[model samples]
Target chain A: MTTTASAPGRPAPVKPGRPLRIRRRMTPRRAGSIALKTLVIGFLLAITVLPLIWLLLGSLKTQTEWLNSPSWALPENFLNFENYQVAWVDGDIGRYILNSALATFPSLALIVVLGVAAGFALEVLVWKGRGGVLLLFLAGIMVPGQMILLPLFSAYFQTHLTGTIWPLILTYTATGLPLTVFMMATYFRAVPREIFEAAAIDGASIYRSFLSIAFPMVRNAVFTVALVQFFFIWNDLLIALTFTSVGDFQTIQVGLLNFTGQFGQVQYGPTFAAICINVVGILVLYLFLNQRVMRGLTAGSVKG
Target chain B: MNNVFGNKRAVLVFVGPALLIYTVIMLVPVLWSLGYTLFTGSVITGFEFSGFDNFAKLFSDPKVGEALLFTLKYAVILTVGQVLVGYALSLLYVFWLRKASSLVRTLVFFPIVLPTVAVSLLFQKMFEVAPQNGIVNEFINFFGLPSVDWFGSPDTAFLVLVIMDIWRSMGFYAVLLYAGLLDIPEEVMESARLDGAGGWTLIRRIVIPMSLPVLLSSIIFSINGTLKVFDSVLALTNGGPGSSTTPLTLLMFRTAFSYGDYGYGSTIALLLTVICLLVTVFIFRSSRRDLTKG
Candidate 1:
């Protein structure tokens, strides 16, 4: 076999004598390759889907059925709402979900507004210390949340912000900024400088150009940042666990942990039901926006 | 354009709010935590200065050693699994599935968005060997193997944690690396195929070298992430049957919050930060050397 180095950005010389194959010819080797690929992919699909199915089936079962039945056994009634009611009411999952939304949306808004503005200015405008500022934000990404947990918790406690959603909102927004601003800067940098110049020549102020021209151009980046941060803040447990002490202020992940600790053993059905609620909430969002979610989440890492 | 864009007030308006918030909430706390390393008490008892005592305690503390060992072991195993499995899956997506891979990608990526606590609960039930065997054990029995009590021991519990976390996160790396793989020009692949480079040869010679940048980035990203793992392990094992599965982050959390040893906890936090920084620098240095040599 010939080994050839195909470095990117250098065009590989095409051999003139070789005919472009329009279709792959079937052979036993190819057939075996196809079989192996299918088997492996099928196994991956099963592993990914089966546990979620188990959760769904378990959620619908009665306690006796859940305990005694085979692990894969389907629930007798698929429409069972009893566990759902128990989880929603007794577990207070609904309230926790609302609290999660309360914390997430406001923080997301702040991250976007601030990230976009900073990203725009840092990348588009003439500024002296922009590189230093960007470096500062980038460095924040490496600081483990562990480092901040103790001090932030104490600060929040002293300021009487421990029991409220402010801690969650503030922490998420602040932590979310580095990546958001970095991503938005990347997006803004891709916009040609001439567009901003044209806007300036049209007598548009910096704010006016940013609001009308630059912002609309990077709406996709905004969406990406918002969606990524939404999932992050929503799925977070550590900060939520640390900051919110009052039951009324707890986010869904924290609430789920507490609910499972309390009801997981004796009430398997409702426990599974509670997990299913959180899963389904995210599953709906993922299904609706999986493409963008996938793109946004990968955008920052893959670009490097 | 320079005059319009260079207004100092506009620049401040654009950048100051984020800078201020990030400084106050994120940056200041890191400095504050660094300062806390010198003091030796929680807020309740009031801090007393004990210069470098916490650092002294960190070296001799057996629990810290065990937690550090667990964290390193977990990070190594999980990073390998996440990156290798993800790379393999991305190869499938690009080479085999191609345009038809989106549905499978979507299914695989589903778990990344699910709350870690929720997924941990599901895994706990799936591996339960107590009152009744979970599906895993049921499968083991189907093959005439004895049911394993997965969480009954530290080793088995660690295995379960690794499997659950890899399942949850490999999709993310797959997606990340998939985007990188997609950047390989079609002509380069076609040319390689013409030269009789197939399968492993094609990937090793062309694809791997071309995608090394993203692959290395993925490795760094995965390593740093696995190093700081807290939520998944917390929800899954809560530091486990004998504190055997506890990572540094969890140890730090318990030290500060539960044990009220803020100074020592901050020291632990500092250790983690240094480890992450070293790992990143090491990878970059090594990769840079490789690039130059190649």
Candidate 2:
């Protein structure tokens, strides 16, 4: 999985007979260089990691402590799950998480299935006017969500789907498709056409060949596309905000926004805790899928 | 093979659902949005064709002008920060850290996946001034300086917004440009080094030109993404401090949804679309011209 993820634009293999450069002896210049590198790396690490740690610590603190204590102070008790309980129950973060999942997962499934099919037809299958069709899809990528927001809302309002998760699912899937199809087409184009031809000669149906041959060949692309779209759908605020009303099918982001407005001033601990809940959910997923996520994101941008 | 693969029915099966959904949900709404610019009022009030009145109103609206200026300023600053910082980090990853940069890259990239609301809350607390001093104020107090209200004024709020966004996104750009850097053959660096090209000279003459395509891609990607800067600003500032920080998207949302003025909102949306298209074309044309010149 890792190998395939990094396959696109992977560094070239070193040439044979290339002389390996010897490391220079420890000198003042080298020492200064190392020192400068250490300073820069350390600064980057500190800026990136410290706020998160501070947030974690803040979440563990009691409300009184959060209000009175210095921001950098450690929590008096690390075992205080009181804020977590308040956040999960009172803040209704769990419901928002479920709502986000409800919107995100179905969107991912649609994007992948539809995207792969469209990509395969556009790139792999012998077809006429695929170029024009592909360009149409690609052009959708440039259309800002703002351009479609008012119309979508108006349409959803008329259809009486304004407060449901349907709008989010449909819009996410549709907007996500342009990139998904483009990336999948890029991936599917790399697969040899002869294999699909061979399968057809062996009496395989188009669906059969796509399912058995093309899909497996581009499994990495599927994962890449899925992960990329997962981040997008999961972290989206605009479509989610526009489609769903407050407290009814509101995704985690909108919920968090309302949560902050409600509790941000008076209840610092639970508010931070609520924010932590959102961050921790994404962090857990990212930890598990970081490599794939990184590779997938880079592959799309670098190659596309 | 030709008969089976080239079947029109199979092609429709493959492409029908996606195209249908894309057209209905995406493409149609865009055209519809353009059409709405000719009408006034929301669905509840019933849209009446006013025929270019929205355009006339859009040109004269002072708030629209403010939002446009803010949007352009925000996009330009954020794009530069995102791409430049990302390029610098990528350079650091390739040249300085090299084989040992993966962990740093991963750590830095963590924030990119974080939800915007969560990051905004964290930044709010970090820079909070009213209820109690946050960490930033704590540090200032430690230095015997007065606590700064980071979000109190428009300038400071915008500053915080810029910092938060750059911090959140630079890592992704780093990894992006890093991928491009990897594709630069090691032999090129080796040969360049052998010719006494070191430090900025090697980067200026070799690395920059070699990685120009990805850099250009990053610039375009960053600019377009920034120009559509709805979520981050929405979450961070909510275009507060008297709408000084409001981008066109948020204003459009407010106009259409909050104020029930769909026609003017769509006009604003059209303006944004035109700006994005113009910027993209400008970048592409200039880059192509540069490529030819070189």
Candidate 1 reaches a DockQ of: 0.71
Docking quality level of the chain pair in candidate 1: medium
Across B131-160, the per-residue lDDT of candidate 1 in tens digits comes to: 877889989999999999999999999999
TM-score of each: 0.95, 0.95
Interface RMSD for candidates 1 onward, in order:
1.3, 1.1
Backbone clash pairs for candidate 1 read none
Q: Candidate 2: what lDDT?
A: 0.90
Off by over 4 Å in 2: A1-25, A302-304
Which CAPRI quality tier does the interface of model 2 achieve? Answer: medium
**Over the stretch A66-178, how does candidate 1's per-residue lDDT look in tens digits?**
77888778899999889999999988999999999999999999999999999999999897999999999999888999899888988987898878889999999999999
The window of 10 residues in a row where model 2 chain B has the poorest summed lDDT is B1-10
Query: Over 4 Å off in model 1, which ranges?
Result: A1-19, A22-33
Residue pairs in clash, model 2: none
